[model samples]
Structures are given as structure tokens and as C-alpha cells.
Target: MPGFSKILIANRGEIACRIQRTAQALGYRTVAVFSDADADALHVHMADEAVHIGPAPVQQSYLNIPAIIDAARRTGADAIHPGYGFLSENPGFALACQHAGITFIGPSPEAIELMGSKRLSKIAMIAAGVPCILGYQGAEQDDVTLTREAERIGYPLMIKASAGGGGRGMRLVHTASDLLAQIRTARSEALHGFGSDELILEQALIDPRHVEVQLFGDQHGNLIYLGERDCSIQRRHQKVIEEAPCPVMTVELRQAMGEAALKAGRAVNYVGAGTVEFLLDARGQFYFLEMNTRLQVEHPVTELITGLDLVAWQLAVAEGQPLPLRQEQVQLNGHAMEVRLYAEDPARDFLPQTGRITAWEPATQSGVRIDHGLIEGQSISPFYDPLLGKLIAHGATREEARRKLLRAVQDSVLLGVQSNQRVLANLLDHPQFISGEFSTGFIPRNFADHSCLRPQVPSDAELAIAAALFYQASAQVHPASLAGWRNNASVPLHYRLGLEDQAWSVELNAMPGEVYRIQIASRSLELKIIECDGHWATLVIDGVRTRHAYRLEAGQLCLFTRPGSLRLTDRTQALVSSQVSISSGTLKAPMDGAIVDVLVSEGSVVSKGQLLVVLEAMKMEHPLKSGIDGVLKRLQVRVGDQVKNRQILLEVE
Candidate 1:
């Protein structure tokens, strides 16, 4: 079989770049398709050829099957690689590629259609002798029928969209009263997310370990399983951390699960890369979840352990080749782990954050790999998934791998946008995780206090250094005043800075030879500047020398230290009027998104915590609630209105 001369990647970001790297290495010219927003994206520049698809929204760009196929046709590419998301699992996209005479590097269209619906997939799995959860996957999808089914299944059941993944369109109903509302919400999200409102109900498995097996197949009917990955460390039913060779998976259990996954794959004539997910209970029993018919986000950990390039295998299988290795021949070596670094705030219910990445620095070390699509000054839009990149580490043992990954995460520096880096580090360091005694509910159960997500306050020495740098920077702008110096020599230079929500007032007394005596609150300290350069400052505080990365932007100063990044607003020149608080009666949008629904109207009386509006952003719905008991005085926004961050949407009295 001959390899494709050119391969078009029908995705963006890190996964697209990842596939292009492997395809190009195998002598295949790579083509990239991008939206208007991604014209200057990394993947566009990395590919041998590029084409513009459409706009920023996924429906007009990445998810536009016709536009993607047109790009492949125009580029004369013989093959298309749908990297993980977007149209990766759409059977219609696969059929379109077949009609366009371009090879779709994944499972067959028949297999994808068979596994696309959770209900249908569960039926097929039962027929193949795979154990499935006890629930209702019937064809009756009406509200009455679903409500009855929920009652029959009892409380504590899950309402899952038949066509959904990544936690979207999923709701856990623990009571009778919440069933109907949750069903409606799930259906609405399902329609928006997967283009289908169909759903399924399952018995909520509490704190089960999410274990999935990576499988590969070819046209020749050969299939092999590539060990298993534990994806139980998750939030909102979405995976955050994944590790290969599950800690508790004995050799016997591994063989049993691997065979069952292979059985599931062969039942649907699965081809190329696919994953069979299962829910492993505490009693050692495992039940089939769903099959993902494409390469997964956590494939890198499996690749690292097996020492095989899964992308290369995907390409090879797409060329009508047989399995290169049999089941007995495949082997898993040392442990490997990967953590997804998303642009989200863990403290604020993990709300997705979008802004410019003013500073970006990744860990560079042997055995540690950083797969990302970030660049300094890049804008993180709210139009796509929040996943920025992945950080993976491999070692001879699990302990070594965890240690290396933790260190790498600590050393990483990302500024201007809130991230889950500190949260990840804390989770890894938790006693439960270190002992491998956690489950899908680990985050909510253990870290609900938000202690792990709290930001570290700067030390006194660091604060003194920041003040000294501020003084020096102020002096550089105006050379005539000798900055912060007074001829009277009796008064101290006063400066005010704000860090997060806390404000600090500092009085610095300039001394001879670039040294200063600084007083913050009641504490006094000494700091000496050894050197000053652009974004880098070397300071000596109390005879300790340290180098820090600093950036000044829009009346604010950011200091990047080993503990983490500190953003301080320079409020010295601002008037008291500028510090006014938001009006108590006004409710603002927390992030940029479109209004999905308005639950309340003007003149309506509402209590605290009453749902007022639903805003959809980053493909998830966020319900904005009334902060206090009051009457709705003004409803400023309606359904379908696009809102900006902190934009007022309603007013109460």
C-alpha cells in the first residue's frame, strides 16, 4: 500500500499541530484548514499548505463539514485527519469524505454511526456480551416517557445526551422534583452541542474509576489493545488528568478489560484508533460506558509507555494495512501521566477565562513534554474549547513520573490569564492522589474548600523588591526629579499598589547607592537593586539575591517568581472615584457569551439565588442568578444577545 502524498488536517490547535508533525515526518505533505480567527495560528504556519475555512464560531469553521471538505478538495489532498474534536466523530463528515474521494483517517462511517448514539451503542454492547449499566436507553424520548423512566430507575440517576461527550448535556438528578428541569436543560444543551436532543438515562455510578482501553484496527480484521488509561481525576465529568497502566489494575484485570474492549471494537468493525471507556467500580467490577471512535486527548500517555507513535499507526491503518503487531506482542513499559492545562479559574467554579497571553513559558526538560499551541501575545478567545495544551511526563516508575510532572508544572509560567496550574499541582501533591486512592469525585469531595486553588501571597522580601523596582522604573521615566527623592530628605515616597482584591500602601526612603528602606504597613525592610533590564529585574533583599520577571502594562505591574505570578495594579495616581464598586442592583455577565434564555422579566420579584439568565459561552451554559432578594427593575438583555465580560444584563431593586 502507498501512503497519502498529502494529508489535510480538519482541526486546529495542539492536536492539529501534533498530527502534522507525524504526517510530515512520514514524507507526507500536510495541509491545514483554519477559521478567520486562526489565520495566524501555529498550525496554519506549521503545515505545508493552508486554507481559510470560515469564521470564528465552530459551526461556521471547524464544524463546517462542507467547508472542510472543500478545502481538502481545493488543496488536492488525498486524505483528511480529523484531530479528536469537531468533525472527528461525525459519521456524516466521514461519508462526505468518502464521496469526495478523500480517505478519512478513522473508523468506518458505518461503525461511527453505530457508536454515535449512546442508546444504540449500549444495545450493541449488550448484544456483544459486554456488561452495561442498568438504565433506560429506550427509543421513547418524550418528556413524559423520560420522566416515567427516571422514576423507574429510581433517584440518583444520570440524564446523559445520547450524542454527547466532554460532560456537556449531562445532568445528575438526585430527586424527583429536579428531574424534569434537568431533563429540559440537558436536552437544550444536547441540541446545541451535538445537533441532537435525544438522550439516555443511567444509574449514577458513584465515585467509579473511569478506565479506558486504546484499541487499533485495520481493514484486514485484525485488532489489538494498547493497555488502559485511568481518567478518573476529572471535574464536571470531563477528564483533567490521565495515567497509563492503572495503579490498581492487576495483570489479570488488564487482560480481562483489554479483551472486553477489543470485543467491543470488533463488534462494530472498528478501524484505526478508537477507545472503549468503562466505569470501574470499587468492587472490582467494570461496566461499559461508551466508545470514542477517534484518537483521544490522552493518547500521548499511552504512546509514551508503549514507545509507539499512535498517529503514525493511524496513518498506516488508513492506508489499508494490517495490524503491525498482534495482541501478544504488544507490551506496556513504565508508567506515564498527562495533565490538561486549561485556561480556567478553579476558584470560580472553574469558569473558562479568555484574554491575551502576555507572557508564556513552558517547562523544558528531558522526559517532560509540553504539547501546546500558545505563543506570547496570543489572544485566547471564548469561541472554542478551553484546553490550552497538555503536560506529559514519563519515567521508569509511577513515583518518578509524578515527581517529574509536578516539578515541571511548578516551573511553568503563564501570565495574563487565570489557569488551573496551581490546582493541578495541589491535586498531585494530595495524599489521596499520591496513594492512588481517588475517583471521579475526587475534586468535589476533597478540594471543595478551595484551599488548593487559593493564590499564594507574596513574601515581605518579594514585596520590598517590587516596591524597589517600582521606584526605579518611575525614576527612569523622569530623569529631572531624580524620582522618589526629596531635597528636604524628611518625607518618604508613598506608593499604593493593589494585588487581586487587596491594596497595599508602601513608603520608600531612598538611600545612597541604589538602595532603599521600604515600609509596608508596620513592617520595614531594605532592598538593593543589583541590575534592571526589560522584564527582568535582579534585586537583593536582606542580602539575598534573586531574579524576577516583571512586566508593566496599563497601570499594572506583574511579577513572575518561583511561587507563581503576581499581578499588582499601580493605584498611586488614581483618584478615589475610580475605585467605585459595582452597583448592588445590577447583575453583570461573568464572561463573554450569548444569552441562551431569560428566566425572569422586569417587575418580577425574585429571591437570592434565583436563576435569572442563562449565558452560553465556550460551549457550556452558565446560569446567572439574582444576588439578593429584590424585584427585577430592568431586564437589559434578551435571548440571543451577545454579551461582553462584566456587561450589565439586568438590574434589580
Candidate 2:
């Protein structure tokens, strides 16, 4: 049979680039679709042909089925590949592709509709003899009915959106008092995210391990399971780290779970790639969680261990092919691990960060692979998922893979935006992770120290080197007889710098031939510049040599080293202090987002730590609370207002 000659990827970011790479290797032309915000994005340039879809927001672009199909038709593409997130699992998109006579590179629309609803999928799982958690999946969604169902299921249950994944529209309620509010929030989020307000309830298992089995099927009814992946390392109910071949899995358990996963697949005549998730408890028993009907974000680890290209398999199956390998022929070798690098601050509750990437350097090694969609000057907007890319490492043993990944992360460089690099490094070194004895509570129970997330302060020697570099750069511009030679020779030239809410004062005396004697907080050191460039500098401090990547942007000095990156402001010329506090009664937006709802009104008395507003950014809802007990004196924002960073939204007095 003839395969597809041209394929169009209907997604953005790293996943889009990933699919194009495979399609190009298979001798197929590739087409890319992008929003206005992503006009110059990396994926757009990597494709054989590019088309503009719509504006920045997803509803106007990626989620617009008509725009995507029109782009494919204009480019003369014969197939469409929905790479994960946006409309990958939407049955409507699949059915529309079929109507347009375009081959959808995934399972049939029937399978998507059957497994898209968590409530319906659970019912099907039960019929297929798969174990499921005790819960309610009724149709009545009124407040009173949900409240009564919560009481029947008892406290500490889960409310999950029936139509979406990625932890969106999901909440854990610990008591009856908070049930109604949570249900409303979950329903609103579900409607906004998935266009469906339907939900299902499940018993919240304590500290359960998240394991999922990978399955693939073909048009000829050949289906097979490809082991499992452990995805329990999470924060805010989203996976942070993942690995293939669960650490605690034995041959017996693997076989049983594999069979159960196959049963679920066969139940829907599942075709293409899919994952069956389960919640593994302490007693070694597993219960069905949900099924993902598209390619997963962590598919790299599975591919690394199994020596297979999942995207290639996806394309072949879309062309009416049979399974390339039987169950007995499938083999799992070596170990692979992956970490998701996000554009967010790990120190301040992982708040999403938006800025321009000044520098981008990815790790390159034999066993390491970097899948990213970033340019040197790309802007990370708060309009989509915060995932920048993923880093994967493979080795013969799990320990080897862990060590290799640590080294790779250290060698990589990503400046300008705050990332989870430090947090990921610390987690890999933690005792629990190293020993492979941890649960879902690992982050909250063991890794609560926010100090690890903060950037380390420069040492006295490093400070002297920075002073020398700054003075040298200044002297070259003025061409003075002697750098910083003042009428009053006894006092040295003083400079001030600010770094992450802290200020430092430096006193420096310039010497001959680009040298300086500097003092910071009673510590003195001598420094000499070995080589000087505006972007990078090499210096010798008290006979110790070091080099650092540097950038000066808008009076802010950024230094990048192997340990980490730090940003400092030149505070010498400021008339007032740079660190200005918000007015006593003002509440400012933490980041750029749309105000979802305001929980309090003016003149209402609220206690400390009361939820005042809910802001939606980067596709997640964050609640802002009152820091002090006070009356809501003024409301500056409404339910549907768009806000910027540090924009005042309300006031309390």
C-alpha cells in the first residue's frame, strides 16, 4: 500500500517539531501551523512548509478545527497528526478529518469518544473485568446531587473532569464543607478547558504510585503492550519526572498489568498508541485511573528503552499497516529517564514566568537527547502550557541513567527565565529518589525546603572578579589616564548592585593593566582580567581562574556559570531604592493572566488567608489570598479583566 505523501502537524511547541522530524525521515513532506504569537517559532522554520492559523490564544488558533483543516488542504497534505495536547484526543477533530477526507494519524473517532469521558471509560473498564476505584459516575450534576454523593462516598474523595486530562478540572476535597465550592470550580474549569461540564468522582487513594502501560494496535486487529512507565513524581498533580519500566515492578505484576491494559484496549478496538493509567497502592494492588488516547509527553523514555520510534509506528499504523512486532518479540532493555523543563519559578510556588530567552544552550551527548522548540530570542508568553522542552538520558542501569542526567542538566544553559533546573537536580540527589523508594507524597513530605530554589550568592572572590570586569568595560569607553583615578585617592570608587531582593555595596580601587582591589562586606580580594569580551569574561582572582557567560540588558547584569545563573541590577545611578513595596492596602497580580473570578466584594470583611481572586495563567488557575485581616476597601478588577505582572487588582484596609 502507498503511504501518505504529505503530513501536517496540527499542534505547536516541541511536540510539533518532534513529529516533523520523524515524517521528514520517512520521505514525507511536512507542513506546520502556527498562531500569531508563534509566527517566528522554531517549529515554523523547521517544517517543509508553514501556514498561519490565527491569533495568539488557542481558541483562535490550534483548537480551531476549520483553520487547521484549511491549512492542510492548502498545503496539499494528505494526513494530519495531532501531536498530544491541543485537540489530539478530541473526537470532533478526528471526525472532522474523516469528513474532509484526510487520514487522521490516530485511532478512530469512535475509540476517542468512548475513552474521552472518564465516567464512561470506567464503566467500560468494569465490563472488561478491570479493577476500578469505588466512586459515583451518575448523570445528575446539580449541586444537591453532588453534595449528597460526596456524603455517600465519605470525605477525602476526588472530583475529576470527565472530558479532559493533565490535572486540569480536578480537585481533592477533604471535607463536606468545601464540596460545593470545589465542584463549582471544577465544573467551570472543565467547561472552559474541554467544552464539557461533566465530572466523575473517585476515592482518593493515599500516596499511590502512578503507573501506566503503553499499548499499540493496528488496522488488522493486532494489539500489543510495551511494558509500563512510573510517573508518580509530581507537583500540583502534574508529572515532573518519568521513567520506563516501573522501579517496583516484578515480572508477575508486569504481566498482570499488561494483560489488564490489553483488555481495556480490546474493549474499544483501540488502534494507534494509547496509555492505560492505574493507581498502585501500598498493598501491590492497582486500580484503573484513566486512559490517554494520544501520544504522551514522556514517550521518549519508552522509545529509548525499547529501541523503537513511536512516531514512526504511529505513521505506519495510520497507513493501514499491521503490528511490526508481536507481544513475545517486544523487548525492554536498559533504563531511561526524562525530566520536563518548565518556564516557571520553583521558589515562589512555581508561578509561571514570561520573558525573552537571552541565551539557549542544550546538552549534547551520546546517550542524551534534547527535544525543544526554542530559539535564542524566543519569548515565553503566558498563553499556553509552560513546558519548554524535555531532557532524556539512557544507560545500562538505572543508577547510570540518573548520574548521566544530572551531568547533562548541569552542562546545559538556559538564561533570562527562571526554570526548575535546580529543583530537578536536588530531587535526583535526594536519598529517596536515589534508592527508588518514594511515593506521590515525596515532594510535599521530603522536599519542602524552598531555599534550594533560590539562586546562590556569589562568593567574595567572584564579587571582585565582577567588579574588575565592570570597571574594565567602563574604562574602555572613557579612555581615562588611570581607571577610576579620583581627586580623593584615599577613597575608592563605590558601586551598588541588586540581586533578588538583596542589595550589595562594593568599594573598588583600580590598578594598572586592568586590575582591581575590591572589598565587599569587610572581605577584600585582588582580581585581574585575563580575557575580556562583552558577552563572556575570564578572570583570575587570587590565582584562581574562572570563566563566565555574561549579558548586559537594560542596566541589568546577568552572569551564567555551570552552577546556575544570576541577575543583578546596576543600582549605582538610582535616586531611589529599586526595591519598592506595594502600598500597604494594595493587592497586585502575581503574573500576567485573565481574572477568572473575584471571591470578595468591596466593604466585605475577610480574614487573613481568605481567597480573594482566582487568576488563570498558562492554562492553570491560581488563587490569590489576602495576606492580612482587613476589609475589601476597593476592587480594581472584575471577573473577565486581563492583567499584567504587578498590576494592582484590588486593595484591602
Candidate 3:
């Protein structure tokens, strides 16, 4: 029955759900493994069977290979698909699956092992005559060796973790003076994130395009390239947007890049689905980046344009079938675009956000697809990656694809938590992006003045509508009286609304025939309610009519408007402190995470912007700095201590 009658997904969240969709569609029983924190996760409920692996921490659950193998044995699943993250590139996991007489549905363990290390892989690619970035992959990892290598590579080099991906353990050093310090920092991050302190250095290519070729190989010695994807738009070395059929790709260039990718794949004798990534410079010369030996997060873009289900291909290959098509027979179709919907605040250093999702409405229309694991009332935890889903669109041309994707992103909804939706929309609508003239430096270059990406306060008209909604919801207590009615037309009822740390006070008074006057701090605006439904409202503010998807509950209001998702807290009657921070001297945990280092001791004199503590959350390190020049008066956290959001980690005076 195509290698195995049952398949167990050794992952969680959207990827697991995505894999299950293809597996079940092919008539294979699917099993899901979840950590303690994911008992009620969407993937668990979607599977034919579910198994609890371990605690909430990844080390105990998702990365617990033995536990996963045990689950497969108990569930009698004959195959396992390590979807992207957790154990996707882990050679040990693949070896374990092989020893358990299970099909790993990926490359050979030797291939995974070789390609997993940036050091080894670079050496192999160079040996195979592939163009590669000039770098240091030497095994000598001492500070002195790294310092010497950094000098040889010159300034503006990149220090990267040899053992992992996802921008973790990566640092871009613009000067030789900062090389040694950055090496130490990258090493520490590498050790914590990937269980290895080894590193690799490379000449950082400034403003180059990030492009990758998708490759598939079967056990019968057949291999084919599935075109390429442009992933140049990135933030913090992590991809934000991706599109298939690189905008500037010509037939000759595609052939050259495709053949080089094939050469890289053949060096490892790679099998199953894999992607060979490269950094293409403005001059048209490309250098090998790395090879990802699994289905990528943005595979949907390739699939959308090619009209082939990659998971189905993996299954067939694992069953010992040849590649579905040869390289010459491969056909490229229309343009396709994709963007990650991350639970991150773009305006706040792209920090990971956590909370419950109160609403879930993905875009549903022609040529659009959403791969997600969200449900209303689901809580977004800090224990995993912040990606909530992906929005993908395909059309006849690049512009058609871009327009469709922009609408899909704006129409999609993920409430009760911060998302990068606004930034995604802004990026899609960007002139540089529309012209296809951007690179990996797109985000930093455009967002250097980050205020443009900052969350705009709800406009006066939006606030007016919000005030009306709040009045209507609260008036349930005074159902007999018309909402917003006042004894004197000159006076009105007071209200305070807050968005994050920004708050404003306003007043509302009833006028004639469904009209009201909203007096803001500096100006007054007229409002008229056209209609109101369960979760929909139509209103006109200052003669501009608009419709909004809104929700008001227990003094908390959520609305979807042109400004993105706005959740405002009604603070008029609440006796809570309006300050987002207790004081400048207080160093609080930004989110639930484990303390990696306590940089300052009690009584230590600290200056403003001095790094005090390092916290690791969602697989990334965030350094908390002193906000004021003072002596550390209290140090409440130690290394490895698990802390909650907003919990005071230290105090100074």
C-alpha cells in the first residue's frame, strides 16, 4: 500500500496538519504525536490516532526520538514523516527510523548527516566543483582560530552555527573588531539551540537574492528539478515572503542554476524531496547556500505553480517508485506567491507573541490556499515556533499573483494575538517588491526607520466606531434606554480606550436618528450607525461609510480594519495601572522563557542599554537591557530558571 498503510507525523502544528491532509487523501491511516502542551492542538484532533509523547519542552517531546519511535510502534504505523522543524534534518532520527524497520520518507542518514553540517556540506560542494561562497569551515573552533579565519575572510563576514538553520546562532559582523565577540556569542547560541558549539564563517554577500531549487530523487537512481523559488525578502535571516519562478529568471540562467543544484544533490546521492539553495548576486553569478533535506515551509508555492502534491511524491518514492517526471519533462506554470503568517509583532523587533486566538477566518476564494493549524479558542504557547500559518496564491502572472495574495493576507484573520499581517501586506504593496527589485536586505533597508512599520493608532473614525460598539455592548444593562443618551446635548458619557501602551479618552452623546457625536481630546466627529449584526457593523464617521468585523467582550474590544487587527482595552472604569511598565528600573521577562544568563549581579552598576539578562524563548535568544543608569538592587532569576511573561527578573535603583 505505497510503502506503508499507516504514517505517523513526527511533528506538530500546521505542518502536521498539512502532511495529514495528503496522507489521508491517499487512503493511509495517520497518527499524530503531541507534547503535553499540545493535547488539544488541531493536528491531534485531525489524525486518525494520537499519542502523548512527553512534557511541553521540545527536548522531552518533539525531539525525543525514542519516544516517537515508540509511538510509531504502538500505533503500528509503518512510516514516519518528519515535517520541517523538530527532527526534520536530524540524521539520528532518520537512522532510528531505519533501525525500527520504518521508512523515513527522506534522504539517507549519510546524506542527512553530511548536509546537516554547514562545515561538511561546504567542503563537499567545493569538492564537487560547485560554486560556493568563500568561507572558513575548518574544524579548529578556538577563539584564536576563529579570529584568524575572520581576518582572512575580511570584514563584514557572517558567523553561522554549523549545526542548525532558521537564523539561530547567526551573526553578521560588519567590522573585524566585533568578530571575536560575535564568534563567542554565535557559539553560545549554537550550543544552546543545536547541541553544538561548532561554527562556520563566510563572506557576507551584500544585497544578493536568495533562490533555491526543489529536487526530488527516487531509490531507482532517478532525479529531477522542480524549478526554483525566490526567497529574497527576509527579516533577521528568516524568510517573510517567497515566490516561485524567480522574477529575473531566464531559460539559460534557470538551466545553469538547475544543473548546479542537480550536481549538489547527486554528490550526496540524495533521495526523496530536497531543496538546494543558493545566493544569487546582482551580477548573475550564484554561490551555493545550503541544501535542506526535507520539504520546506514554502513548498506550497512550488506546488501551487507546478500542480503536484509533494507529499504524494514522497510517498511514491518511499514505495520505491521512480521520479514522476524527468528534468526535461518538468514544466513550469504561472507565478505563485507565499507569505508566512507569524504570531509576531513586526513593530517590536519582530518579537514572538503568545495568547489565545479568539477568531479564525482564513481567506477562501479561487487560486488561494491556507495551510494552518488554528482554531478559535486555541492558545498560542511560548514553547514552540511562532508561525501560525501561511497564505499562498497562484495566478496567470506575477502581478496577478501579487494582487491575489495581498487581498488574501488582508482578508485573513487571526485575532487575540499580534501577527505580521500588516507588515506582510505592506511588503506586498511595496513598490520595490512589486517591481521585483529587492533582495534579502529588503526588510532592513525599508524598515530601518521602523516607525513606518509601527502600529498606527486606530484613526479617529475607527475610534468613533469602537466607541459606538462599546456603548451598544454595555447598554445591555440599560436595554430600556437608547444607547448613548444624555440629559444635556452639550455633555456626553466618558470612555477610555487603550491599544498597547497608547490610550485615549473620548465622550459620546446621542443625536437624532441613529447619529451620535464623539468628542475626542482635540476634536469632535459625527457618527451614524447604518446597521449592526452579530459580529458585523456598518457605520459612517464624518460622512465616510465603512464596515468592520468587530467583537466587544467584558470591556475588551477587537476590530479588523484597514489598520490591521486592533484590540483595545476599555480603561474608563477599570482601576488598573495604565503604565505598561512598572518603572524604568524594573527588568521584566518579555515572555515566558528560560533564563540563559544572569549578566549582572546585585549591586552591580549598570548603564542604560546595558545587557543584563539573556532569555531564550521560541528557540531564539533575547537580551534584556537596563533601561536606566543605576545599581542592580535585586536579581531574582538564575540561569536555567523558567519565568513567565511580565514577571520581574530584576530591579535596579
* Best candidate according to TM-score: 3
Residue 630 CA displacement from its true place in model 2, Å: 4.9
Q: In model 3, where do residues sit more than 4 Å from their true spots?
A: 480-491, 511-513, 575-583
Better of 1 and 3 by lDDT: 3
Number of backbone-clashing residue pairs for each candidate, in the order shown: 0, 0, 0
- lDDT by residue (tens digit), candidate 3, 1-653: 25689999999999999999999999999999999889999999999999999999999999999999999999999999999989999999999999999999889999999999999999999999889999999999998888898889987899999997999899999998888888888988899889999999999999999999999999988888999999999988899999999999989999999999999999999899999999999999999999999999999999988999999999899889888787777788999999999988877787898888887888898999999998888888889999999999999999999999999998886678888888889899999999999899998888777553677678887788888888777666575674337344566888898887888898999776667899887889999888977477888888888888776777888898743689988888877674745348988888888998888899999998899999888878889998889999999999989999889999989
Q: Tell me the alpha-carbon RMSD of every candidate.
A: 2.1, 2.5, 1.9
Worst 10 residues of 3 by lDDT: 482-491
Please identify model 1 stretches exceeding 4 Å from their true place: 454-459, 483-491, 561-564, 578-583
Error of 2 at 577 (Å): 3.1
lDDT of 3 at 607: 94
lDDT of 2 by residue, 1-653 (tens): 45789999999999999999999999999999999989999999999999999988899999999999999999999999999989999999999998998999999899999899998999999999998998988888888888888888887999999996888899999998898899998998899888899999888998999999999999899999998999999986899989987899999999999999999999999999999999999989999999899999999999999999999999999999898999999999999999999988877788998888888888798799999999988899878999999999999999999888888877678888878888888888788898888888888887777566655676666566556656665666676754345333466978887776777888988776666778899888878788877777888787788777776666676677564577777777878654544335678888888998899999999877889999988988889988778899999999989899889898888
Compute each candidate's TM-score over C-alphas: 0.95, 0.94, 0.96
Candidate 1, 1-653: lDDT as tens digits: 55678999999999999999999999999999988878888898899999999998899999999898899989899999999988999999999999998999999999999898999999999999988999999999998999888888888999999999999999999998999999998998899888899999999999999999999999898999999999999988999899998999999889889989988998998889999999999999999999999999999999999999999999999998888899888989999999999888776778898887888788898899888888787888878888999999999999989999998888887877778888888887888899998899998898888675665566677677777777777777775787438233357888887776567788888887887888988898888888888567888887888787777766667777653577787778877554324336689888888898999899999988889999888878888888888999999999989898889999989
Question: On a 0 to 1 TM-score scale, where does candidate 2 land against the true structure?
Answer: 0.94
Which candidate number would show the highest lDDT if scored against the true structure?
3
